[model samples]
Target: MVTAPFNWRPHSRGRIADDGHGSAVGPQQAVDVEAARAARRRLVIDRSCRVPCLVLFCSAVVWLLAGTLLAMIASFKLHEPRFLADFAPLTFGRIRPAHLNVVAYGWAFNAALASLLWIKCRLAATPLRGGALVLAGAGLWNVGVLLGTLAILTGRGHSTAWLEFPVPAAAMLYGGFALVAIAAVLSLAARRVRRLYVSQWYLLGALLWFPWCFTVAFILLMPAPVGGVTESAIGGWYTRNLIGLWFSAVGVAIIYYLLPKLTGRPLYSHQLALLGFWALAVCYPWTGMRHLIAGPLPAWAITVSIAASVMLLIPLLAVTLNFHKTIRGRYRLVGPSPTLRFIVFAAVCYLLVGGQGVLLALRSVNEVFSLTHTIIGHAHLGMYGFFTMAMFGAMYYIIPRLTGREWASVGLIRIHFWCVGLGLALMVGVLTAGGIIQGLELNRAAAPLGHYIDEHGLSEGVGAFLSQLQVRGGAVDFLDVTRGTIPWLELRTLSGMMLLAGHIAFAVLVGLNVAGHSPPRPGPMLLSAAGRGRPLE
Candidate 1:
C-alpha cells in the first residue's frame, strides 16, 4: 500500500477485513492501524473527490454576485443618494452595509470555510459527515443574509454597518456557523487520516478566529458592552478586530494554501510563517485604537495603538517575503494555474494595503484623511483589494479539487478576476482621490486652524466653520492648499461612481457567464491542474 508523502495517521480504518487472517487475536481484539489508515484514506479520497467541491464553488459565485450588487448600489448612493431614495428599504445607506456584510461574511467567509473544511478533511485523512448538514448550514446562512439585508434596507439596521443584521438574523447566522464549525471539528476528530498540514493551521485558525471575534463584536455592539460614552471606542475596536482577526485570517490562509500549490513546492520557510501568524495575533487588538486617533480616548490608548500599527510591518513583511521567495521562478506556472494568479494578486495587495494602513495611523495624515473617502479607500484596499482577492484565489483552487473536475470554464475565472480586481482598483482610485481632495480642503489651514471634520461636514462647529471659510476663500482660494495631495471628496465621489459602474458590469458578467456554463464530470486524485488553463506549449 502507498503511504502519503506527509507523515500522518489515517483517521479510521475498516474494522472487519483482518478477520480473514485468522491470527491468534480475535476478530476485533486488536486491529492493525496501518491497514485501517489505508482503508479510511481511500474512502475519503474516493468520495470527497466528487461533487462536494463543485457545490462549494457555485455557492461562492452566488454570494459574490450578491456582494457586488450591494457594492454597486452603495457606490451610486455615495455620489447620488437619490438613486434609491424613493425606496427607503433599498437606500444606499442600507444597501451599502448590506453589501459589505454580504461580501465579507457571506461570500468570503463561506468560501473560506468550505475550502478549509474540504482541505482539512483531505489533509487529516478524515471524512466530512453529513455533507447534507454542510449544505443545510450554508443554506441557512444565506437565508439569514437575505433576511438581514431586507431588514437593514427597511431601516431595521442598527447602523453599526458591519453588524447591522438584526437580532434574529444574527442568531440564525450564529446557528449556521455553529453547525458548520461543529461539523468541521467532528470531521477532524473522525478523520481517517491523522496528520495535520499547513492548510490545516489556517482551517483551525479560521474556525476559532471568527467565533472569538464575532462573539466579541456581538457582545460589545449588539447589546452595548458599556452604557457610557466610551462605548463607541469599544465598538470601533470590535469592528477593527473582526476585520483584523476573522477576515484577515481567511485571506492569508488562502494565500498559504494556493501559493504553494501552484508552484508544487513546500513553503520555503515554515519558520517565517509562524512569526507572521503570532505577530498578527499579538498586534491586531491594539491597532484598533489607531482608528480613535486624537479622539476622546486617552493619550496612552492612542499611543499604544499607533505603536502596534507601525509594528504591523513585521507580519506584513513576513508573509510577503515568504510568498515571494516560495513562488520565485514559478511565474511561468501562474498562467497555467488560476490558483497562482488569484493568490499572486492577493499577496501583492497585502503589501500595498498593509503599507497604506500604517501610513493612515500617522497623526499628520489622519488629521487630513480620517473623515473622508480616504478612510473608505484604505478600508477597501484591505477588504476588497487584499481580503476579497485572497478569497477568490481560494475558490478557484478549491473548486476543481473538490469537484474532481476542471472549472466550468477558464474564461469565467479570468473575467471574474479582472472585473473584481479592476473594479476594486477603480474603487480605491476614486475613493482615495475623493478623500485626498476632501482632506486637503479640510486641512486648508491656510484659512484657519483647530478645525475638526467628519467624513462630511456633519457637526455644527465643523459645518459653520466650513461654510464661513467657503465665503472667505471664494472659489479662487481653493487652488493653493497644502498637505499631501489626495483628491477632494467631490472628485472622490465621481471616481466612486465610475468604479461602481465597473463593479456592476463585472458582477453582471460573472453572473451571466457562470449561468451559461454546464457542469463537468468528476475524476480522481484532483491533480493540481495548476495553471490558468493553458498547457506549457
Candidate 2:
C-alpha cells in the first residue's frame, strides 16, 4: 500500500538513531528530525512558488472585484432596466456577457492556474522551474482577459456563449495558456515522486482537456464558422466540456488535495478516488450533447448525452462518499479552519450541482427549463457555488503558506463566507422557483395561442384577432409571462448586493494579508475561540 507523502508518522518508536560518537538518539528525536526535514522541503517548494502564485492570485482578485461589479449591474438591470439604460456599454446584453467572460477567464482561470502551480509543485516534491515563463504567461493571460472584457463591453464580442471573446483575444488567451501548460508539463517531468496521486491525475487531465476543447471550439466557431444547428451544437459542446472537463476537474482536484491535507488524514479510499476519476473521464465528454437536446441535433446524440449525464451519478457518488468519510471525524476542524469550511461547502455544492445536472438533462425537465432563469440559476450554482467557492478555499489555504503570514482578520473571512453563501443560495433559490413559474406560464400561453391561431386563422386583421383571442380567454399575453418573473428578478438583485458586500470583505482580507499588515504567526490561524494559539498536532 502506498502511504501519503504529506502525512508523516514514525513506524516504530523502538528504532533509535546512532549519534556520531556511537551514542543512541531517542526515537522521538529521530522522528522530529524527519518531520523537520519534511517541513523544510515544503518551505522550499512554497518559496519557489511564491512569486508566480502571488501574481496570479492578485490578478484574480482584481478581476473578481470587476466581475462582481458587473454582475451586480446586470442583476439589477434585469428588474429595473432603466437603472443603466442610458449607457450603451452598460446595457444588459453587453454587461451580462462581459460579466461572464471576465469572471470565467480573468478570475477563475488565474486562480486555478495559481492553485495548479503550487499544488503540483508540492505533490511532486519539486521546486518550480521556468518561473519566468510562468510569469510571462500570467501577464499575457491577464492582458488578453482585459482586452476581451473591453471588447465585449464595446460590442465586439462573438455570439458564442463561452467563446464570446473576439478572435484576436482568443488567440492571445491560447498563447498565454500554452506557456503555462509547458511549465506544468516540465514540472511533472521533473518530479521526485514516482507514484502519481489522484489529484495529479486530475490536474494533468484538465491541463490537456482545456487546450483541446478551446482550440477545436475556436477553429470551428471563429475562423471557419459552422452554419445552422451545427453551430449551436458545437457551441453547446464546447461550453459543457469547458465547465465539466476544465473548471470542474481543477475544482475536484483541489478538494481531493485539501480535504486530506487540512484534516491531516489519508484519503478514505484511494480506490474510490480512482473510480471517480475514471468514471468522470468517460462520462463527462459524452454528456455535452445533452445541452443541445430538442434542437436540430440527432436524436441518438441527445440520448447518448442523457445517458452519460445519468452515468455521472456513479462518479459523483464515489467522490461524495470518499470526501465525507475522509472528513467524518474532523467536523469540528471545519468551524475553525476557513479553508476546510469553504471546501466542505464547495463539496456539498458539487453534489447538488451534479445531481441537478442529471435531472436537467432529462428530456421532460429540459423541455421546460431550457432558455429560462432556471438554467441561469443552475449554471451559477455550478460555477459560483462549486468552482468559485473551491477556488476561494484554495486561495485561503495557499496564500498564507506562500507568504509566510496568516490572514489579517478572521471576522472578514466569516463575513465573506456567510454573505457569499447566503447570497448565492438566495439567488439560486429565487431564480429556480421563479424560472419554473415562468416556464410553465410561457408554455401554457404558447399552447393556447397556437391553438387559437390555428382555429381562428389570420383572416381578420392580425392585431384585432390577437385582441379578440385575449378577450375570448383563448390565449395569454407574452408580456404577462414576462411580468411574472419580475418579482424573482428583484430578489436576485438583492442577492447580488449581498454578494458584492462579501466580495469586498474578501478583497480587504486578501489585501491586508498581501500588504504584510498581518504579522506572521506560529500556528495555523483557526476560527475557534479556544484554539487561537493551538498548534496542529
Candidate 3:
C-alpha cells in the first residue's frame, strides 16, 4: 500500500498518471506528480487574487509614510511642546489622532485585507470571485481613510479612541469593508475542498465579528450617543475588540498558515488549535472592560471583564505551545527565509503582549499604570510588534508568488528587520521604565518638611512639596519629577525616526519588486552561504 503524503489535499484528484498509465508508475512518482498539479492549481487561484491584493498593499504603503510623518511630529511635541504649538492642526491632540487613524485603518487593516484575500483563495482552492469589486472596495477604503485623517486635522474628530472617524467617513469604511468581505465569503463558499483548514476558522470569524463590533461602537459613541460614563465603557470595548478579535485574529491566522508550510510540519495538536480558537471567541469580547477597572463603570462589569481578561491566558498558552512545537527543530529556516523569521518574531511577540495585557488588567496594576505611558507601550507592542510584523511576513511570502519575482535584496531585508526590532525595543523599554517612575511619583505623598522655600524663595513648605509630586507637575521649573520624562520621550522620538527609516526601505523594496526589477530565482532567498541549496525547512 502507498502511504499518503502528509498535508495532501483530499480533493486533489487530477494526478498526472490518471490517464490509464498509472499501472506503470511507482507510488512515489505518482505522489510527486499529484503534488505538482496541486501546486499549479494553487498558483492559478493565487494569480486571480493578485491584482486586488497589490492595489491594497500599494495604498497601505502610501498611508504608512503619511502615518510615520505624523508620528514623528507628535513624538517631537512630547518633549518640545513649543515646536509647532502655535498651529492648531499641528498640535499634539490633532496630530496624534490622525497618526492613529491612518496607521490603524489605512496601513494596518489594508495590508491585513491583502493577506486575508490571498490566504483565503489558496486555502479554499478556488479563484477569487468579484475581483473588480474587491479592487473598488479597496479604493473606497483609501478614500475614507484619507478623508477621515484630514477631518481629524480640521477638528472634526469624534472623542472615541479607535472610532474617531466622522459618521460619513465611517459609513464609507463600513460599506467598503462589506464589499471586500463578501469577496472572501464567496470564495470560501465556492471552495473545492470540503474539509476546512485551521486558518479558515480565524479568517471567517474575523470577517463576521468586525462589522458587528464596528457598527455597535459607532452607534454608541456617535449618532446615538450614550450619556455619562457608559460611553467610556463602550469606547473601551470597541478598541479592545478591534485589536483582539479583528486584528489579532487575522494576524494569528496568517501565523498558523505560514508556520506549517515553512517548517514542513503539521501543527502539533489539533485539539490545542481548537481550544485556542474557541477560547478566544468566547473570552475576548468581554475582556474589554478591564480597561475601565476603577472608572465610573459598574462594579460587576469591571469584575467580569477582569475575570475574562485573566481567562485569555488559556488561548495565549495554547497558541504559544502550538507554534513552539511546530518550529522547535526547524530553527534553521529562519536564517534563509525572511518570511519565516518575521513570522516567528511575531509569534513570540504575541505571547509577550498577551501576558502583559493580563498583567495590566489587575486592579492594583491598573490603578498605578492607567495614567502612565505604560499603556502607550502596550499598544505599540500589540499593534506594531505583533500585528504589523505578521502582516510584513505575509506580504513577503505572498508578493513574490503574485509578481513571479524574488525579493530585490536580502541585505535590505536584514536592515529592515534589525531597524524595526531595535527601534521597537528602545521605544517600549524607555516608555515602560519612565511610566513606572511617573506612576510612583503620582501615588506617593509629599515628604515631611519644615520651612522649605519655593523656587522664588517663598516659604510654603507643604504646598511646594505637594506640587512636586503632582502628575503634571512641571509648572514651577524643570526640576520637578515629571521633568525626568523628557529624556525618555526624546529617546522615543529617535526610535520613531529609526522605525520611519525602516518603513521607507520596506516601501521602496515592495515598489521595486512590483515594477518587475527583480527576477524569480530557483530556490528560496537564504541569508547564509551553506543554506542556499538545502530544501526548504
Question: In candidate 3, which residue pairs get closer than 3 Å at backbone N, Cα or C atoms, i.e. clash?
Answer: none
Candidate 3's TM-score reads: 0.89
lDDT of 3 at 486: 80
**Candidate 1 regions off by >4 Å?**
1-3, 6-46, 49-57, 191-195, 445-537
Candidate 1 local lDDT, 17-125, one digit each (tens): 1111111122243346644654455455537533444455556666777776676566656546577688776776677788877776677767766766766665555
Residues 1-537, model 2: lDDT tens digits:
223232332542111111011111222445565556667777888899899899999999999999999998998888888996998999999999999999999999999999999888877778888888899999999999999999999999999899999998999899999988888888888887666777899999999999998999899989999777888888888999999999999999999888866765556777888899999999999987887878888899899999999999999999999888877887787888888889999999999999999999999889878888999999999999999999999999899988988999888999999999999999999999888767655653333233444676755433343454334233246776677689899999899889889999999988988999887956688777754443232
Ten residues in a row with the worst lDDT in model 3? 14-23
TM values, all candidates: 0.78, 0.90, 0.89
Clashes of each: 29, 0, 0
Could you say which candidate leads in lDDT?
2
Candidate 3: clashing residue pairs, number: 0
Model 3 regions more than 4 Å off: 1-31, 445-481
lDDT of 3 by residue, 1-537 (tens): 122233442333212111111111224545577666666776687689889999998888888999999999999999999998998988899999999999999999899999999888877667899898898899888899998988999999988888889998998898889999999999888876555667889989999989998999898888889878888888889888999989999999999888877765556667788899999999999997877888888799999999999999999999899889867888887877888888988998999999999999999888878878888898988998999999889888888888888888888898888888889889989888777656655555343222234443445654675566654432332245467578889999999988998898898889999999986745566766755654452
